[model samples]
Target: MIRKKLNLFLVSLWSVWMLQSCGNPPLVDSTDLVIYGGTSAAITAAVQAKKMGKSVIIVSPDKHLGGLTSGGLGWSDTGKKEVIGGLSREFYQRVYDKYQQENAWKWEAKSDFGNKGQGTPALDGEFKTMWIFEPHVAEEVYEEWIAELGIEVLRDEWLDRETGVTVENGKITAIRTLSGKEFKGKMFMDATYEGDLMAAAGVSYHVGREANSVYSEEWNGVQTGVYHHRHHFQVLDQPIDPYWIPGDPSSGLLPRISAEHPGIKGEGDDKVQAYCFRMCMSNHPDNRIPFPRPANYDSTQYELLVRIFDAGWDEWFDKFDLIPNRKTDTNNHGPFSSDNIGMNYDYPEASYERRKEIIQEHRDYQSGLLYFVQNDPRIPEKTQIAFKEWGLAKDEFVDNDHWPHQIYVREARRMIGTYVMTENELLQKWPTPQSVGMGSYTIDSHNIQRYVDENGHVQNEGDIGVPLPGPYEIAYGSLIPKKEECSNLVVPVAVSASHIAFGSIRMEPVFMILGQSATTAAMMALDQGIAVQDLSYTSLRERLLADGQVLTMEDRIIAK
Candidate 1:
C-alpha cells in the first residue's frame, strides 16, 4: 500500500511535467467553431464548417481520425443510403475513387473486385461502400479531409470535464483540460459517443435504459420471453444447468448467471448497453495473427461457453460479421456472446484508471474466449479446427496490441435535448421536422444483462430487435439543444433520443450524416450571427436541401 501511494504520487508529478512539456496552443478568446470528439461525425462536421469558410478546430482525445468507421466496426450499419448526402456521400465517393486505383488491391485482382463490389444491400449504393473498410483506409479518408480543409486538430488531449472550465453567457469563455491548457470558441459541438463535452457543459442526459412506460417504447428494459434469435444453447437437450452444484446450488454461484432473477418486463434499471472489442479477424494463412491468451487468463470464466460448445451449438458464424480484406468485424449475439454485460456499469462515469481496468477486463475476457474456442478440448473438433484458422488481423490497430482502441459502446449518456425523439417520432405518429438524415434499421439493442430465471435457468434480457416500418426523418432539432440550454452548441452522436429510439439511428453512417448536418448548422449559425436554435427553419431547411440532405421522405421542402 505504501509503495502504491508513492507510485501514484510519482505518476501525478510526471503527468504535471508532461503537461508543461506539451505546451499550449495560443489562448484564443474565440473561434468560429470548436468541435469536440474524434468521431467520424466530428471530422465530417469540421469539414463541412471549413467548406462554409468557417474557422474550425477539432479538440479530440484520439490520435487517429475516424472513430468506429476506422476502428474495426467495418461491417457498417448504413440504414437508408439514399437519405445520406452532402459530405457523408463525398466520403464514400472517395472510397470508390481509391478502389479505382490499380494498386489498391494487393492480393485480389483489380478486375476481380467486380460483382461483389456492390457490397451489402443495406450498406452500399451506386457511389461506393465506405462502410466496410480497413482501419487505415478509413483513417486516410479522414486525414484527407483534414488536409483539404487544413483544420487544426488537438490530439490526445482529454477534457478536464469536472473542474476544467466554464461557459458564460451565450459564448463559451474558457474550456480547459486537466493539463491546464484552455480553449475558447464561439460554437462547440459534442460529436462524441461519451458526450464528455455535453456533460461538462451541464447538459442533462440519462445514462441507462428507460422504462417502457417512459416513452411508451415497446422494446425497453428487461425482455426475457422474447427469443429474437437462436443465441441461447438452452434448446440443446440436457441443457447446461445454470447451477453451481450441477443440480443443487445451495452449493454456490454458476459461471455466467447472476443470483438475481431477470427483472420485470417494463421496469427501468441502471443497465447501460453491453460493450465489446470488434476483433478484426482473418483466416488468411499467411497474414493471420493467432489469438493469444491474455496475461491474466482465467479458464473457469469460460465454463458456460464450454458447455455451449459441448452441446451442438456449432454456429460460430452467428456473431461473426464480415468486413473488408479477409477480415470480420465480429460482434456479440444471443444471450452469451462477446458482450461482457453487467461488467461495465461504472465505465461512463468512472475515473480514467478505473476505466483502463475495465477495458483490460473486457480484453482479457474476449481474448480468453477466442483461445477457448480454438484450443479447448471441450469444443467440437470441427468448430475448433475452423476457429484455429482464424485469428486477429495483423495489419490493423497496431498501437493497441492489434486490438481496436475503442469498444462498440452501444449506448451511453443520452442527452435530453429540446426535441426528444421518442418511439412516437420514429414510428411516424408525428412527422420529423427538418430532416438532416434518415434511418430505417431495426431498433436493435444487444442483451443488457444475464441472470437466473424463475425456472432456475440462466437467461439474458434487454436485447430488442424490432424492425422499423420504413425510413423516417431525423429532425434537425434533435441535433441541437434547446436555445436556452446552449445557444452555439450542437450534438450529433449524442442527439436527443429516448433510450429505445436511439437504437436504430445510432449507426456510424447516421452519426456521420448528422455530423455533416451539425457542422452545416454550426457554420450557418456563425454566418447569420444567431444561436443554432434561433436560426430560421425556412433558410436552414433550404440550405440543407440544397446540400442534398434528405430532410423528409416526402418531396416537400418549404413545408408549403
Candidate 2:
C-alpha cells in the first residue's frame, strides 16, 4: 500500500512539473491597473499610472518598448507641436535632453545635422523637445523611464484571445496570457495598435473604413479616383500597363497588381490600409548593415516597380527623413515604395500564427525590395548606385537583425466606443464632447489596394490625405467601450474613431497624449470605485489640465 501511494504521489508531481514547463505559471497578484502592449502609448500610460500613485503592471507582447516610436519611425509626424503636452511632450523633451550630451552624437555631429523637420525644427531647443531621434535612442528613453518609475513589465506575455478573459457582470476581472500567467486588475488599458485586449474582452470594434454614408463623411471609404499624396501611379510620366507583356491581356497581370475590379469611390469595403516597417537606414559605413536577401525573395515580385521606374518615376529617396547620427527614418514614398498595398487586410483579426506569417511576408517583401534596388540589373544604374550608399542601421533592433522589431500597423481594430469620432467632428462640422486630447495631423491613409484602372493601367487606390484646418479635441468617450460591453477597460491606441478621423489621430504623439489621459481617468475611476465608463468627464478634464495635457485649441493658444 505504501509503495502504491508513493508511485501515485510521484506521478502527480511529474504532471505538475510538466504543466509548469509548458508555461502554465501561477496567478499574479492583482494590481490597480493592467496596461497591455509595449507601444509608446503603453509606456506613457504606465508612466502616468505610476505618477498617479497607482499600482500598475505592463503586460507586453513585444520584447521591446515604444512600439513604432522605437521601431524605425524616428521622424515624428507632429502636425502642431504646441498641442502635444503631458507625458507625450515630456517624452520628446527627454529625447532632446539625451541629444544634448556630446556622446549622443556618435556617427555625426549635432551641428552637421540640420534642425529641419516637417515644418518646424527637428530639435526644438526653445521648447526643450526633439521631434526626431534614432530607434535606439527612443528605446533607451522608454527603458530608462520604466526603470526610473520601477514599473513592472512582463515581456513576451501574449494574451490568450480564447478562454483567457474572465469577465464578471460586464467588467474584465482578470486576463490570462498564453503562458497561463493570470493578471488581475481593477482597471485595464489596451494600448496596442491592434486592439488585441479590447477585442478579446468582447468590446465592439471596427476593422475597416465605413462608407461615406455610414458616418456622412466625405473621406471615409474606398477612394478609387481620389489621389491626395504622390503615392498614386498617376505621378508616373505615362500609364504603366498591368499585363506582364505591356498591353497584352492574355499574358496575365504583373506581380503585385490585383486582378479584381477597383471598388466604387465612396462605397465601403472590408479592406484596411497598407502596412510597412519604417526602415531606419544609415549611410555611415561603420553603422550600416547591408540588406540581406530574404530566403523566399522573388525578384519577380518587383516587376511592377520596374515598370514604375520605366514610366519615369525617380523620387525614391523623397521620404528618407533624416534623424540624428546620419541615420534616416525611411518611409514609403512613391507609387511602389515600402507600403505593401493590400497585403495586410486580414492582419487586424488574424491569429498569432497567421500574423507572424503576414509579418514575415512583409519583411521578405521589404527586404527583397532593398536588395533589388541595390543589386537588380533591371533597376536604373544611377538609382542603384545612389541606393547602395544606404543600408540598415546596425545599431537598431539588434535582436531582430538590425531590422525594425515592430511593423507599422498604421490602422487596425479601432474600438466602437461611447462616441465614434468621424470626419465631421475632425473638421469641426460636429462638436467633439468631453475633450481628453487633441490631434492636428492631416487625415492620411495609405494605399489600400492596387488594381488595373479603366484604361488598363495599374493604379493604387485609397491613399487619402486631407489636411486639417487646426488641431481638434479628442473626445474622452472615444477611449471607453460602451458601458454594457466592458466597463473596466480603456483603449488609448485603438480609440473609437472613423477611418478618416483615425488617420489624423493615429500619430505616436497623439497616442501618448491619449494614453496619459486614459490612465488618469482609470486612476480617478479607481479612486471613486466606479467603472471606467462611469467616471465623470468634468473631474477627468480638471485632472488632465492639471497634468499638462493639451485638450483644446484654446489650450494650445494659451500654451503658445
Candidate 3:
C-alpha cells in the first residue's frame, strides 16, 4: 500500500513537470499559412508567404533550421546551376555574400580554397554564389533570413498525428502540436523529409520502391544486380565469405548481412536507400575532435569491413568532400561506410520515441565504425593512420557534440498526389505537366540492402547512380494531394514521385524552389478562396515567371 502511494506521487510529479516543460498552451491563433517543417523549404516558404502579404508561421519539428543544408551536406549536389533560380539561387548567392567577407575564412586562407565544386566553381565571383559552405554558416544564413523577414518559427513543436489535426469538410482547419499548442491556418505546407503531416492529414503516400511495371519505367524497383556506384562489395576480385565459417550455412550470416532474399528484380518492396549522417571532419589538429569510442562499442560488428578491406577495397577517403575552411563533408563511401543499410525501413512511420532510439543506434554504429577504423589494430596500419588524421570538426554542430543533428533520410513517405513524378517523366519519355520547379540531379540512390548473393557471398544491392539526360521540370500536381483528401496541404520535400524519380527531385535546391512555388500557390488560393488543385496553370505560370522562377529552358519558353 505504501509503495503504491509512492508510485502515484512520483507519477503525479512527472505529469506536472511535463506540463511545465511544454509551457502553457498558447491561445489558439490563426495565420494565413502554417508551414509544417523547419527545413530549407519551410524557411523559404515562410519567407515567400510573408513577402506575398500573407501572415505565416513555421511550426518546425526541428530546433535548428535548414535541414541537411545546415546539416553537414555542405558539398551541394547541384546538377546544373543554370536551372537553379529564384529563391534557390538566391540562397547560394547569400552563401557567397557570407563567405565574401574576410573574416569568414578562419581556419584556412581564402586563396588556399581553390575554386572547386560539383560541375561548377566553388565560389562564382560574377554570379555572387558560393555552393560549398560550412554547416554553421548555412544555419546562420537561415536564421538571418527568418529574423529579417520577421517570421515566427515555433521550434521543437512536434505534430500530433492522433486527434491533433482538425479537419472540416476535407480541409485541415487547424493542427495541434504534441505539446497542445494549436495553430490554425487557411493553407498548409508539409515540407518534412518524412511526410508526417501529409500522412496524418489523410493523404495517401508510398513508403518504398515502386515496381518498374507500375509506372512502366526502366529503373524504379528492386535492382539486385545493377551496381552503378562503387558502394557494392568488391565481389569481382574475390567472393567474400558471408558466413563466419566459410561455406557453412549453419554458422549463420555475418553481422550487417541480411538473411532474406533481395526480392525480384523490377519488383517493389519496403526497403529504402540507406541513411547516414554527413560527418564534417577536419584535418586541422586544433579544430579536430578525435572519434570517441561509443558506448557499447563492439569491434566484432565491423568484421564484414575487414573482409571488404582484405578484398583490396581501399576507397576510405573517396567521399571526404571538401566544403569550406579546413572542413570536409565526410559521407558514406565504399562497401561498408556510414550508411546503415536495411536498418531504417520502419523509420518513415515510426513513433517519435522509437525514432529517437533508431537515431541513437545509428549514432552508435557510425561512431563505433569511426573509432574502429582509427584505433583498431585489425584495420590496415596505413588506412588506420590515414583515418586517424581526420576527426569531427570541432566548430560545427557544437550543440550536438560536433555530430550532425539531421540524418540523411534519402527517401521516406513520398505522397501519392494528383500526378506522381515517375522515371518516365524524369527521363523525358513522357511529357511533364505544369512546371513548378526543375530537378537536374542524377537519379542517384545509395545501397538499400547488404544481402548474400546466389554465390553465397555477401553483396550490396540497389546502389543506383544513373545520370539524367538533362534537367526536367517538376509538376505542380506532384506537391498537392488528391482533391478529396486534404485540399490545403502542399508537400514539397516528400513530393509525389516514384522512388527512382524522387532520387532526382530530392535535392535540397529543388526543395527550396518547390517550397517557393507551393507558397505562391498557397497565397493565390488564399486570395481567391479556392483549393490548390483548382488554380489555373496559366496564372500560376505567369506569377512564377514574374518571380524569376526558371519554369523552362530558353528554347522551350520561346516555343511556348
lDDT of each: 0.76, 0.92, 0.90
lDDT of 3 by residue, 243-295 (tens): 98989989988889999989999999987999999989999989999999997
| Over 4 Å off, model 3 | 1-29, 234-236, 555-560
Q: In candidate 1, what are the lDDT values of residues 339-419, reduced to their tens digit?
A: 897888788777777878988889889898888778788878887877888988877888877888887777777888878
**Least lDDT summed over 10 consecutive residues: which range in candidate 2?**
551-560
Give the top-scoring candidate (lDDT): 2
TM-score of each: 0.91, 0.95, 0.94
How much is the lDDT of residue 394 in candidate 3? 93
lDDT string for model 2 (1-560, tens) is: 99999999999999988988997774457799999899999999999999999899999999999999999988999999989999999999999999999999999988999888877799987788899999999999999999999999999999999988899999999999998888999999999999999999999999998999999999988888899999998897788888988889999998888899878888888899999999999999999988898888899999998988887888999999999999999999999999999899999999999999999999999999999999999889999999999999988888989999999999999999999999888888878999999999998999999999998888999999988878898999999999999988999999999898999999999999999999999999999989888888889999999999988877772324
Candidate 2 has which clashing residue pairs, if any? none
On the 0 to 100 scale, the lDDT of residue 275 in model 1 is: 87
Order the candidates by lDDT, highest first — what do you get?
2, 3, 1
Superposed by TM-score, candidate 3 places the C-alpha of residue 233 at a distance from the truth, in angstroms, of 1.7
Sort by TM-score, top down from the best: 2, 3, 1
Model 3 TM-score (2 dp): 0.94
lDDT of 3: 0.90
Q: Find the 10 residues in a row with the least total lDDT in model 3.
A: 551-560
What C-alpha lDDT, on a 0 to 100 scale, does residue 339 get in candidate 3? 97
